[model samples]
Target: MTETTRTEASKLMTEVEGISGAVLPEPAPAEAVTPLEQASPQEAEGIRQRMAELDMTDTTSIVQFGARAQSDLQSISQEMLSGVKNKDVGPAGDSLRQIVTTIRGFSVSELDVRRNRSWWEKLLGRAAPFANFVARFEEVQGQIDKVTDTLLSHEHKLLKDIKSLDLLYDKTLNFYNELGLYIAAGEEKLREIDATQIPAMEQAVADAPEADKVLHAQALRDLRAARDDLERRVHDLKLTRQVTMQSLPSIRLVQENDKSLVTKINSTLVNTVPLWETQLAQAVTIQRSREAAGAVREANDLTNELLKANAKNLREANAEIRTEMERGVFDIEAVKSANADLIATIEDSLRIADEGKRKRADAEKDLVELEGKLRHTLAAANSSKQAGGAV
Candidate 1:
């Protein structure tokens, strides 16, 4: 009887495995797969052989994350060797190297995926519900694995976005800063024209009113157009500052939510899966008890063993599900504060640049005035000397 039961169980297990084999997703094709180790000469030879037998584009691989013992230098060296072994090209090699590089910096994959949840969502539990599944058993570990891949991919994109946005902001700020200085310099020169130069020019203009009107009108028009340009640039800077400010809440919320989700997923996964070793042990013990029973079995009692095993599983599953459902919310204050700081920086940077421009424009107006006065003084001196000689 015992031999019969064991054989039955083995057969059942085999059948289950067969069912699983059908549903398993095929490993992704390795277009740009690089690993985090230098394959030894022997391993390299093995890869070479493997490559020869197969399509290079069809290789599939698993990238391990959360191993902290390896240094960046070590990871890079490993990737270099792996690249040679696989003979990766173009996107495949680049993609594989990037995954290895990013995983090296973080604690785990949850820490890496930032796109789905904002920083605030993590703190406040707004999106906390989505991560519960990620916390479940190793049986569902593949779901968690998928999420991690998504996270790593997201981290790369966010990095590129941050760098690009920062570059634009920096360039725009620099342009405005330089333009402001020119405006200020022009304004200061305009201011410095001596009081008497105005009257002297008027007297000179009396001798040729039409010429003076044409020249002065054209010069005034040029100055006015320049003033309009400076005002437009300043106005554009202000609008950009406002747009960037409005984005702060969303950008910061994303970062906060991502961190929150990683923590929750880690807690759920650890709580639900490791307990399985205990569950399986209990299941085995219950089966043994049923096996040892003698002639005392009745029809109702015969079904009792199966019922007991199912009950234990139901209880454990229910308990874990309950705990996860009741998990507490996170605090969003940190995320809010960060948003405020970024907004403040945007405002402050714009103000500093604008202030410098205003001062420079004032200085230019003064300088222009001084230039006109100096020209007038030299003209008056020359005219008087000629008049004295005539007398």
Candidate 2:
């Protein structure tokens, strides 16, 4: 017999109970005994509760999510002007001269990753970046934990990942709840820099020094490239958030459906098992437990109706997401033009570096040959003078 079964009988009803008024122990609290009673229920309820808590399964979206961003549009000299004023402009005209020359000598390049964002995504991200931000942070933390464990010998990747998510989630929530308005206000300032400040500054870079222009140009190109990468990543993230969010209810439906299905199965098994067990033990049998019989009958009808109605809706949502994924498109021309001037300045510098190495090698070889010729000429001249003196 099970430990539970052994403890459950009426203690065999002591003999001479009429003379000695048989004593019985107090019953355990209902809450305390409840789990014990449910233990024979096959643990299906526990699994069902846990299944409800997960949010990842019902997802069918691939929409990006994160902060709204504009791709790069400012050049090197313009970048400096954006950050500085007249005194800083001291003799920049000379820098522009050399920068132009440097560009002529080197193979300049502007690099930007292709990226795109639709109005719908921009709207969503601006409306709710936190959802995507949290996911991004979690993903980053997972990568960190994986790398750190390999490099630092830490074994608790899951613990580390969860810890990072907890901290990031708390920090981000506080920022949005307390400081989001301030961040929203800062958006106007960024917009102004883009629409007014940067353009005017670029036009005024007319007299920058050649060397400064070269360095500034390269810096600007690098900066633009970095921004391009960020915008692409954010766009990708925003799309993810959108698709996942959309798929949530359907996924939850599926999860609830799954639990109902399992509960029915387990309840059916337990009901049948007990029907036989009870018959063997006490020669008593009930055709069905109330819950098992009801669940079996109701769940089949309920789930069948759900599949008939909601299955088509899930299929329609899938089509919408698939259309978006297939039509991946973005315009990066503006970004390239903005970084173009600075990139032009690097071409000359790169070429000069390569040519300088070649020139130095040739000069060394020439010097070696000249030294050998000089030694031979000196010996012949000395020998001619010695022969004339001997004669």
Candidate 3:
């Protein structure tokens, strides 16, 4: 890790320790004394032999392990970042909006009975608004069902994301634990080089002759380089561990958001939908009752109108019958009018008979005159014919 990262990690660790009320052991000093100082001659000689046997190759496995751990940590970090980025609640918000719109679309006014319609319109069922109301209700219910399905799907996705986050959290913790072990191992190896191996190599270089000093010094340089490499590896592991630590909370935060969305979806399904449906059903019932009452009122009004008209017609007819019953069998005025009509008919018949007789007499006289004229015309024709013959 860089110096700044190290400093930050240390501060974070200190804060954690303070909150937990647990004091961590202090790190070993750079110049701490080694066991070699207290050892006997044989032990010291054995340690010197072991230090001489140590080569740069001994750290190869540790370096490879660190590299592998770093790669794994990188992969874990990337997976976590990608998961967090890809998770979204926009679909849930859309479902909520759909729900609100569906709820707002409900209007009881649509169910109101049309009172101004004519009797024929009611008889034909045109004035019955319940059919349209029921259709609208069904349509709104279908919309609600669609919203519910969408919410449920979104909730399932959130649940799946939360499960993935749990797995990611576990992986991060594992990486953190692994990094702790790697850092501990690297620190121990570094302390060994600082306290024992390098010191032994330095002593050997000081005691050797000039020609051999160069070889011992080169070995010392190699040991120091290995120590530096181990330190760098430890720092790299610490940085990776810090990344895992940060990832822990990030995964949890994303999971929390998913959980919150799931809770809201559950509330919408379990509470809001049921309550709305119940209220809608009640409204429909009330509207039906109102329509029934209106029908009854219209029937009563029509009955009253028919009764009043019948009563008025009956009164007029009864009055006319009472007047006819009160009068004589033959009314004087009716008899007088009938007698006058009979007399006028007789006079018209007599006048018509006299006129026909006179016309017939005149016709007879005209016939006699016509016959004389025909005879005279016949004689004239005969004389003219005879004269022509004699000539």
Task: Report the CA-based lDDT of candidate 1 relative to the real structure.
Answer: 0.43
lDDT of 2 by residue, 36-133 (tens): 12333543343233223322211211011122211111232244344333321123223333323332432111110112445876766642333343
Please state the error at residue 33 of candidate 2 in Å: 51
The global C-alpha lDDT for each of the candidates, from Candidate 1 onward, is 0.43, 0.38, 0.69
Model 2 Cα RMSD, 1 decimal: 54.3
Per-candidate TM equals 0.26, 0.24, 0.48
Clashes of each: 51, 30, 1
Please provide, for model 1 over 39-60, each residue's C-alpha lDDT reduced to its tens digit, 9 standing for 90 to 100.
Answer: 4465445434432332212222
Across residues 1-391, which tens digit of lDDT does each residue of candidate 3 receive? Answer: 1234334334433333332343222222212223454555764554454344334557765466455445665686687567556546887888888878877876656566663556776688773567777888888877877677666667656766766766666666666655555565566567777999889999999999999999999999978888887778678767767766776777777666676667677666666777888888897788889878988999999999999999999999999999999999899999999999999999999999999999999999999999999999999999999999999
| Span of 10 residues, lowest total lDDT, candidate 2 | 106-115
Model 2 scores a C-alpha lDDT of 0.38
Q: How close is candidate 2 to the true structure, as a TM-score?
A: 0.24
Worst 10 residues of 3 by lDDT: 24-33
RMSD of each: 61.2, 54.3, 13.8
* Error of model 1, residue 33, in angstroms: 52
Which is superior by lDDT, 1 or 3?
3
